[model samples]
Target: MRVLLTGGAGYIGSHTAVNLISDGNKVLLYDNLSNSDASVINGIAAITGVKPTLIKGDVLDEIGLVNAIEKFKPDAVIHFAGLKSVKESSLKPLEYYSTNVGGIVTLLRAMLKTGVNNVVFSSSATVYDSRQKMPVDENGIVGNAANPYGETKIICEKILADIWRRYSLNVTILRYFNPIGAHPSAMIGENPVYPNNLAPYITEVALGKREYLGVFGNDYPTVDGTGVRDYIHVCDLAEGHSLALKNMDGLKVYNLGTGKGSSVLEVLRAFCNVEERDIPYRIMPRREGDVAELVACCDKAKKELGFAPVYNLTDMARSCLAYARKNFSGKIK
Candidate 1:
């Protein structure tokens, strides 16, 4: 099948392109190289042996999207382009909403004109309200986002839902847990603008980018007084996209996680074990809107999409360390 991947040159999108091409599907990647570099396309081509059709364009541009859809005529589309930084969203909520919310509308309009219906969206677990219990399922009540970034995601979901109400748009919304780890080949991984995520921060400490790590809070009432989260490998997350396309029959929501939650200190210890060096750290006060534990109930994904994470915590730590050490200069790890 021919597939169009928006933001396909970004971190997870690049990895997903590799998997899709490996599975013998034709892919055309549409990206603006805003947060992602164009060289990522070369990296993916090197690994997959088949470079996807590259279109330099913005999803918010109706003319550009129409041209891409007309040229590629993809059987399905996986939308991954948007402003993803939570803190940035707080500062520039309008920009986040414009890019995320407006981009979806533009794509949907273009798709309607071109008659391309299948879609796979990269939603987040942040869509779950703060009142959610420990393990969040697809049935958990949706609420207003704690941050602007999450709010944009919720807005996009609503847009997609509204489109589906009138027509049969086969869509699958995959709410990802915390994704970490580099590809085993060490060619591609996450490249955060500010590096706020836990894995990148840990990697920075190991690489001596900073003198010591700072814990957000240690009195969260978790197992070790730190926050707990479900960390899934990036490669496995990419694999889930392929399965999602197979199961995109209706408006289905699946949690892409391991169904196991690990604490902050536990991840630090795991990294220490992988790097063979003790990590120095200092605990700090909790930040605003920080939750104690965020885990996913992934039984639906496992049963329906046949999704199962093969990499363990040690694997994640090792790959993350390798990427951090190799590309600590802030050049697309």
Candidate 2:
């Protein structure tokens, strides 16, 4: 199958590109290089021995998207391009809406023009309201997102649903948990530019870029008294996309995660064990909108898409450390 991946040069998209190409599929990467680098294409080639065709463009550009869709004529599109920062989105809500929501509008318009109906959207677990029960599933209520970033994701999911209902479009929505780790090759990984996620911040501390890791709220109701989250390896997340593409028809939703939770201290200890070095840290107040636990009930994905995470926490930590040590020079970019 021929696939076009928006944000294909980004962390998860790049990994997905390799997985798709390795499975005997043709992939064309379209990215704006906003939060990703073009050199990731080379890294993907290095890992998969096949370089995906790349078109430098944004999802908001209807003309560019139409041209690319008509030219590549992809069998499906895995949409992964958007601004994705919870705190930043609160400060810049308009920018988040304009880019994320507006981008989808333009992309859908172009896809309609080109008659490309299959779409796999990159949604988030953030769409699940904090007040919902633990182990969020596809059937969880999706309003009251904690931040604007999550709001945009909910809005996008609604937009996809509406399109599916009105146009009979094929849409698959994959709600991802905390994705960590890198490609085992150590060639490409999460971006260091303004690192916002826990894994990247832990990597920075491991590489001596940061003085200490902040343990947020050590009093939460969990095994270790810290917040618990489902951390899925990026490679596994990539594979889920491939499976979604195969089974995507009408509107379907799945949670891509390990179905297990790890606490903040547990994650820190895992990274330390992988690096074989002590990482300094101090307990800090829990940030706003943080829940005591957020794991996944991945039964739907497992039963329907045959999706299961292959990498454990140690694997996630080791691969992340390898990527950081190789790509970073103790500089916090």
User: Which candidate leads the pack in lDDT?
Assistant: 2
How much is 179 displaced in model 2, in angstroms?
A: 0.3
Q: Indicate the residue-level lDDT of 79 in model 1.
A: 95
Per-residue lDDT over 1-333 for candidate 1, one digit per residue giving the tens place of the 0 to 100 score: 888999998888998999999999999999988877777777787788886777889999999999899988899999999877766678888998899999999989999999998999999888888567869888888876778888888888888888887888988898998888988877777766657678888888887777788898999878999989899999999999999998778788899999899999999999999888899999998866567888999999998889999999999999998877666666433
lDDT of each: 0.87, 0.90
Please provide TM-scores, in order, for all candidate models, with all chains considered together: 0.94, 0.96
238-264, model 2: which lDDT tens digit per residue? 999999998977899999999899999
- The TM-score measured for candidate 2 stands at 0.96
The lDDT of model 2 is 0.90
